[model samples]
Every structure is written in C-alpha cells, then in structure tokens.
Target: MRTEMFVDGKWIGATGGTFASVDPATGEVLAELPEATEAEVNAAVDAAARAFESAEWAGMLPAARAHVLLKAADLLAARTAEFAQLETRDQGQPLAISAGFSVPNAVEHFRYYAGWVTKITGITAPLSVPNVDYRTRREPLGVCALITPWNFPLMILVWKLAPALATGNTVVIKPAEQTPLTTLLLAEVLAEAGVPAGVVNIVTGGPEVGKALVRHPKVAKISFTGSTAVGREIASEAGRALKKVSLELGGKAPSIIDADADLDEAIEGNLMSGLLNSGQVCAAATRFYVDRKRADEFASKVAAIAGSMKLGSGLDETSQLGPLVSLEQLEQVDRYVQIGRSEGADLLTGGSRADGDLANGFFYRPTVFGNVTQNMRIAREEIFGPVLAVLPYDDADDLASRANDTDYGLAAYIWSRDIGTANRLAHQVKAGTVWINMPPLLDAGAAWGGMKASGMGREMGWAAIEDFTEVKSIWTSLA
Candidate 1:
C-alpha cells in the first residue's frame, strides 16, 4: 500500500505526525500512514489551483479530459478485485459488499462522468435587447476540496471527484482517516491513466486537516459527505469565504409499509436497505412506519431476519454482516440501543455486541425495536448502525406527516401493492429520493441528496455537474 500522501503528482512524507490505520475486523494495524499538516494542506490547494489554470489540464480539449476519466475507469475495472480487498480490509464492510457494490459503483461514476465531458455546453439566449448577444457559459469552479466519510469511502469520493474533474476542476481529497488505503491506491491508477500532475491530490488526516482544506482561500469549492454537524461548520466557513459548497450529510430515512403492502417483500426490503453495511449508510432506512394492524408482524419478521445475520470479519466469505467501522462507532450504537430500551421501545432481537470469535472486533449485532414512537431518540436521531426502530401508525391520512416528522429528509422507502397509493405517498414524503416497492437503489444517472437538514446539494447524475460548475453570462454588443 502507498503510505505517503499524494501531492502534485508526487509521494511526499507528511509534515504532520503519522497515524496507524487499524483493521476494524481484527484490531490489527494495516499500515502507518502520514497525516498532512496545515502547511501540507496549503501546498495541496496551491497545486490544485495551479493545475486548474494550467494549459496541460484547463486548456486541454474536453474530449481529452473525457479520455482521461474513461482510461481511469478502465484501470479501476481491471484492478477491481485488488481495490475490493483493500476496501474490505480498510473499511470493515463485508467483502461481498466491497466487491459487488462499492468498487463497481466507483468505476461506473467515472464512466458516467466521462460521457458528460464532451456534452457539457453553454447556452445562447435570445434577449429583448437589440444588437446584443447573450449566452451563459458553464465553467469549472477551480480547485475543489472533497472531504469523504469512512462508510463508503471510494464510492462517495468518486461521487464528488468524478464530476469535479469532469467539469475541469482540480481537486484535493481528504479521505476519512480510518479508511485511506483504497483512496491512496487510486492516486496510482489516475497517474497511470495519464492524469496531469497536480490535477488531483490527496491528504490523509482527521478534522483538523479537513478544516484547513475547507478554509483554504485557493480552494474554490467544498464537497463534503459526513455528519450534519460538521457539514454546518464547513458551510459556515465556506459562506464567510463565498466558496461554493455541496454537502451529503446525515439522514434518518424512514420506510413505510402500507396495510396492503406485500409483507414478505417489505420484510426483505427493510432487511436489505436498513441493515446493509450494518446500517452505516447516511440513507439507510433507520425508521419504519407500518400500518398499526400489521405492525407486530412486520417487526417480528424483521427481527427474525436480523437475528440470522452472520457477524464476522469482512474477509470471511460466509459473513453476512461486518463490524462497525471502529470501537467508538460500536459504543455509539450501543448507547442508542440503550436509549431505545429506556424510551420504552421493545427490543425484539440482537441488542448487544457480538461475542466469541468476533469479541475483539467492533461488532454490534443487528438490533430491532418495536412500538417505537416518533418522539423517541431511537426513532428521531441518526443511529448510523444496524439498529432499526419500527413505529406503528393508526391512520393513513396522517401517515405522511408522521413519516416527515424527522429533521432528516435524505432518502425514504415506501412499500405498497397498490401503485396509486405508493405514488401518492411518495409525492407527499419530504425526502429527496423516494423508492417505491423496492430497497435503496442508487443510480449514477439520477440525482441524490436531501430535502431539509439532511443536506443542501445533490451528488449524482446531471445535478452533480451543476454543483461542480458555475454559470458565467457573457453579453456582447454588436451594434
């Protein structure tokens, strides 16, 4: 693995101290990596700014830029297995998920954005003024600072990186400290794919490094995916500087099961969407609202499925669920589980940490709580773990209100056999993305973000292009 930080197309040792990258599955040190200092962060931003203005990058043809992204995508596809293994080792997600979902998704983002490179165009508008020409040019925002979380490091990084680069913006990335291995490796792939020097840089550190990058004057934009609290801080700093910012933050997404919904399908959808990656996803279906008459059955079925999940190391092929990202995360999940009990929600199954062979790792059993109320902490706050809180609702008339009660509005799932009812409820929900009769499915071609406190901007599809670029209106007098 590459241990040093990538800056200006070169591997440099950090001025800041080194930190150990621990394997959450075995509590073993995978690598001791360098943490970039404030000085180093400035260097990265300076490099990115220079690259953004350089002829080798900024002046290159759009087709050439697309070629670089496509080549990078091809290289990533070739090394998918290697990347998947490193992701599983570094991030503690199941190997199957790393291989099947995250790595593949990263490749697709590059390819998808590559296709957009040549297609990005300016618009000529007809104005009422005579002897004048009016047009709007979509231009890159220069250097972008991408601060990604540990849960889906590679995928989310590309969610920001692909579009930024597609629009001709150079970037400096700060991968979550806990899982920087795969991102460091990607620097090599981009270099091999002929990305110009200084166009992409990476610094590995915690919040201090992130704060420095966000506050850097040369950094024209900031794209962040993490907690809502941190997002607020970044937004505040960026607002003061007038820097463009897009955040994909925390979520407490709710899944609703209508009275006429298919019970078995709803149960399966909840298990897959809510408990995937042990529910560490920002858009995981943490809250479930079911018809009161069938609530008991839905909760029971969910508990039974969650109880059967195999918790072990990500490298273990037979393992169905992996450990939480770290010990701190494990404790946080446990605290919420305790809060659920205190709030009088019924703990249906798997409420404690896994023991035996998985005892040393940060493994929490998939937990489910029934009879959860909207006011309860477990139902409202983002647990960000494999803890599900199922709430029973009496009236369909007010179901939309009950579901939209949370501060988060990132993503929601609705299950109903009647397409009309599902469509109606989908329109009523406040979430940015609503899935009907399905689990959480994300596409590179579709926009993804939140409606309220969940976040301020979208991350995928054409929406990403808008986030990474700025419009410049050019008016010419012909008379």
Candidate 2:
C-alpha cells in the first residue's frame, strides 16, 4: 500500500510522521502510513482549489466528466478482489462483505453518478415581469472536503466523491486514520482512470487533519460521514466560514417487530441488519422495538442467532463477523455493555469480548440485551458495535413514538405482514430511510441521510448532486 499522502496528484511524505495501520482482526500492524499535518492538509485543499479552477477539469463537458467516472468504475470493478481484500484488511469487515457489498456499492456509486452527470439540470422560469427571460443554472460548488469514517471507508468515500465529481467539483478526501489504505489505493485508480491531476486529492490523518481541512478557506464545501459530535463541530466550523456542508452522521436506528410480522423473517433480518459489519454501520438497526406479546420469543431467537455467529479474521471466508476497528472501539463497546448491565438490562447471550483463539484480536461477541427500557443508554446512545438492545412495546400505537424517542433518526426498519400497518408506521417514523420487511439495503439511487441529530444533508441520488452544487438565477432583458 502507498504510505504517503496524495496531494496535487503527487505522492509525498508527511511532516507529521507516520503511524501504524493495525489490522483489527489480528492486532497486527499491516503498514505504516504518513500522518498529514496542517501543512499537508492546506496543500491538498490548494491542489483541489487549483484543479477546480483549471480548464482541464472545469472546462470538461458533462459527457467527458461522466466518462472519467465510468472509467473509474470499470477499473474498480476489474480490481474488486484486490480492493475488497485491502478494505477487509484495513476496516476489519469480513472479506465477503467487502467483496459482496462495500466494493460493489462503490462501483455502483461511480456508475450511478456517471449517469447523472448529464442529467443535472435547472429550469427556465416563466416570470411575472414582461420582457424578462429568467433561468437558473446548477453549478459545481468547487473544492469539496470529503471526510469519511472508519466503518465503511472506501464505500462512503465514493458516496461523497462520486457526486462531487459528477457535479464537476474537485475534492480533497480525508479517510479515517484507522482505514486509509483503500482510500490511497483509490487515488491510484482515479488517476489511472484519466481523472485530471489535482482533481482529486487525498490526505490521511487523524482529527487534526480533518479540522484543518474543514477550516481551510479554499474549501467550498464539506461532506462528512462519522459521529454526530464531530459532525456538529464540522457544521459549526463550516457555518462560520459560510461553506456548504453535508453530514451523514451517527444513528441509533430502531427496528420494529410488529405482532403480525413474520417471526422467522423478522428475527433473521434483525440478526443481519444489527450485526452486519459487526454493527459498525451508521444506519445500523441497533434498537429493536418488539410487540410485547412476541418480545420474549423474538429476543430468544435473535440471541441464539447472534451467539451462533463465528468470530475470526476478516480474511477467513467462513467468519460471519470480524473484529472491531481497534482496541479503542472494542473497549468503548464493552463500556456500553457494562452501562446496559448497570441500567438493569438483561444480557441475553454474549456481553464480554471474545476469548480463546480470538483473544489477540479486538473482537466483541455479538451481544443482545433483553428487557432494555427506552431510557437505557444502550437503547439511546449510538454504540457502534455488534450489540443489540431489544425493547418491548406494550402498544402498537406507541411503537412509533417510542422508536422516535432517541436523538437519532437516521434509518428505521419495520417488519409486518400487513402493508397498511407497515406503511403507517413508516410514515410515522421520523427517520430519513425506512425499510419494510427487509434488511438494511442501500441503493445508489435512493436518498440516504437522517433527521434530527443524526445528520444535516443527504448523500446519495439526486439529493447528493444538489448538495454538491449550487443554483444561480439569471435574468435577461428580452425587450
């Protein structure tokens, strides 16, 4: 893997020194990556800004821009296995997931946005004033700083990068310090795909680099995916500079298992959605609200399924779940597990970290807490781990209200045989995305974001194009 930062289309070493990129599955240092200081961050933004204003990129036709993205998609698809392995190694997700979901999704984002490049349009307005021709133009925002989280490193990077590039905006990306390898690899892919020099720049580091990127005056927009606390800070800083910002932040998504729901399907769906990527997803269904009548049975099956999951190295094809991103994450998840116990929630199956053969890695057992109240921290806070808090709901009428009680409203899941009831609850829920009788599946065409503290703006589909571009009104005298 490339250890240096990619700035202005050139690879350079960092002045801030290097840090070890440890593999979470084995607690092994995979590579040492250069940490970007403020100097490097500024250099990246400067490159992006210069590229944004350059004739090579800025003057390219929509079709030509789309070609670059499509070529990148083809290149990525051809190297799926290579990218997936690196993603699994860097991010601690199972190789199956990296290959099946993450890498494929990244490819789809590129292709999807490539299609949208020519479709981005503004309307000509029929004005009240006579002899005046009025129209609006949707234009690129220029020099976007895309900050992605450790959980879904390469996929989420493409989530922001695809749209920014589709809208003709240059970007400076800051992948999470824990998982920077795949992003670095993608820089090579973008460059090889004929993306102009400096059109896409990458600087890898910790929070200090992110702060510098956000504070850079040349950055016209900021697209972030991570914790809500950090999102709030970025929003505040971007607001001060009056830069456009889109944040896909933390989520405490609730999954509702209604009385009439198919029990088998609901249990399996919950297991997959709640435990996928070891429950590191931002829109993960961490909170489950079951009808009181079936709560006991539902919790039992979920606990059994979670317990049956195999914890091993992400490179192992048979491993259903892998380790947390780091020891720090593992400790945080365990701390929340303890908090759940103190709040009187019952630990149904696994609670502590994994032992025996997996002792060296940062693996936490897939845990489910029963008898969890709405007031419990596990049910309220965003615990980005493979831990589920199942809460019982006494009435169907109160289900939506109870699920919406948390500060997060990113995504929610509802399982019901009755479409009317499912649709009703889906409408009642305040989250940005809601699924009925299905596991959490994302599409490149669907709008993904949140309500309330979860986030500020959407990331996928046309909404993403809007977020990355600006609208300008123009009036011409026809008389």
Candidate 3:
C-alpha cells in the first residue's frame, strides 16, 4: 500500500523527495512518507482554493454538512480499534490512552462539531432605517491550512477539521512528519462519509510542507498546534500574507494545591494531567505548588504514585505510563531530572529511567523533584515529559504571582474545596482556561486556547467556529 501524501482524493509520492517515519519506541521504520516540496503544498492549497471558490462545498446546507460530519464520526467510532492501534504504534502513546481516551474524544469532537454545523446562526440587525432591513452573515473562509502535532494526532486533527468543515471551508492539513498514518486513515473515513473531493486533503512532510501551507496565497486561514518556537514562525509568515490564523502552542501548566483541598483528588488530577500520553500532552501539569506545611506529604504522595505506575509497551493493558514519544524526548526528560538535581532541588524519588523489562523502549522513570523553586529550570521551562517538580508557597498571593510568572498562559490547575477561593484564584491566573479541583478535562463545546505565547485564538465550541469563518454585514437601503 502507498504510504504517501493524500491530495485531492488520491495518494501519491512526493514530487521532490521521500522521508521515513520511524517508530520512536523501537527505532524502526513504520512507513515511507513523502517529503512534500513547496510546489506540492502550493498545489494542495490551490486545489482547496478551487474547491472553495467553486462552492463545491459552499452551496451545501449546514444540515447537509452536519450529516457528513456525523457520518464520518460514526465511521471513525466503528474503526476505533484500528486507529487506536496505529496511534499507539506510531506515537508510542499508551494503548489505553489512545484507545480509551484520545480516540474516543476525537470521535466526540467530530460529533459535537457536527451538531453545531446547522446550529451556528447570525442575528438580524435592529434596523434604524424605517423601510430598510439589515442582516449579518457568517461565511466560511475560502480555504484553511491545518498543521497538527505528534502528541495527540487524532484529537488535534479532529479539533482542526471539525470546525473548518462544519463552517463550510475546505482545508489542506499537514500532519506532523513523525505521525501521519492516522491522518491518512482519517482521510479514508472522510471520503467514505461522502465528503467532496478536494474539500479535505493531507500532505506529509517536515518544515517545507508547513512553510508552504502558511505562505500559500490561496489559503485563507491557518490553524496550527505545536511548540511555541514553530508557532511564532508560522504567525510571522502568515502575518506577512495577512491571513487569518489560530494557534495552540506550547504550555508549562501548573497545578496548585492549597491547604483546604482534597489531597486524593488533587493527586489524581496531577498524575492524569502530567503522565498521560507519557507527558507529551501540551497542557500536562508539569509544575506543582503546594502549601508549605503540607508540601512534604504532597511530594511523598506524588512520588509514591509516580513510582507505582506500570511502564511497558503501549499495547500492554498493564502499562499505565508508556514510552516517551522519541528517544530524544526521553533524553530530554532525563536531562531535566539532572537539571533539577543540579539546581539544588531535593530529589525525593524517581530520578532515572525505568529499568528491568521496560528498558528496551524509550521509557524514563517518572521523576519528581521537591523544594523546587520558580527560578528552577524544570519549573519554568516546559519539560514535556513525565517529570513533575513540586514547589511550596506560603500564601495565596505568592502562589498566584508565581503561577503567572511564565510567558505561557495556555492552561492552569488549582485544587481546593473552597469554591470561592478557587474561583478567585482562577480569575487571577494568567491562562485561557483554569480548571479548579480537576485538570486537563475539556468539555466538547468549551473554548480552548491560550494567552501570551502559549497561542492565539481558540479551538472547539461554536465560538471557535468564528475563527474558521468570516463575518460580513449586509444592508439594503431604499435611498
């Protein structure tokens, strides 16, 4: 079978060159994907532009669009096992995470957005002219460029595609070079759902393809999810083109545990948000701040839980924490442990890679550092691993200030049973979303994005559809 780029209802090799998709876990070849050239990206954008301009999708009723999306969601749900297995093998995410979490949530996103397709409406203007009436319209942008990350490929793709398609825009998505197969699989399901040709296409490659999509004149909007470094570049280039863009970038989220919080529930949120998907998650709670008096207990509890998780192949049901997405990622996580030690943070437990039967893959011990200060490297920068650094603070004001110190404002977590205090803290935290008493739980219709460099604009919800669309006012005066 061809493991090439998907363009305009067909799969083919790259015009310029080819690249290999390596299984980051075993360091083996998964498939040979096309290294799409600038010309190829331009071509895909052109196809999308043509489809959009011709209104191949434009004239379709919103209910019709919703029907197709719902059908695709159903198809994906039925093929859940297949996509889950592929996601596990390629990205090294736990099979349970892929199968039980990301995959199911992906389907949910599609189904949710599908319902919104017909529900999105524009209001009639209250006319000042006696005989003249005015109206507003929400129109889909002509074409969009979607760029996804390796960490939650299926979920992120759905986040991009659902709103774009629901709003009646065509798209040319560039899947991350590391994990492209599941996206290709999605293309198959989209076609089976009766989406029109050229309405949605995907190209696989590295920087060149992404560059092409961002700069292509035919593309109207670009929605990207990746590291902040790359996101900055996309925003810069897209700015030059004067195109619409939405980015969901990097995050170094914090989970603050106060004196009055439920210790058990807070620990559960910390682990789930930090260690799920091997800490490859963007909003993973990497930094933990606790009350000074309870700091020791919190640190010990977290360490115990981190040490107890099973590490093995994602396919193994017993495995809770899977391999890091790549060897480089594993090394990066380990390096942070070293950094934490060097920076004078107390190494309570788990400061090395997991040994024994799990040593074959890129597995690292889920490390924890106590007495971590805000200035410490691990607490400030995004480690993007299963390592959690615990810091202690005396008061709410200090904790709030420390939490908002970083440039990232993607998401933050606060744990306390005091709803009033939690609400006040949530208001002060510099983030797009703050979850109190919980972590990383996204409602299907909730708006998701970041402040500062974490990213611009937002995704999910009917409000997010506004990002993929354009608003125009129409007036007719009998003057």
Off by over 4 Å in 1: none
Tell me the TM-score of each prediction against the true structure.
0.99, 0.99, 0.97
What tens-digit string does per-residue lDDT give for candidate 1 at 29-97? 999988789889988888888888885776789999999999999999999999999999999999899
lDDT string for model 3 (3-77, tens) is: 877777777676777888767667678888888887778778877887888887867987888889999999999
TM-score of 1: 0.99
- Best-to-worst order by lDDT is 1, 2, 3
Q: Candidate 2: TM-score?
A: 0.99
Clashes of each: 0, 0, 0
Total clashing pairs in model 1: 0
Residue-level error in angstroms, candidate 2, position 281: 0.8
Candidate 2 weakest ten by summed lDDT: 50-59
Query: What does the lDDT read for residue 242 in candidate 2?
Result: 97
Give one digit per residue, the lDDT tens place, for model 2 in 173-255: 99999999999999999999999989999998889989999999899999999999999999999999999998888899999
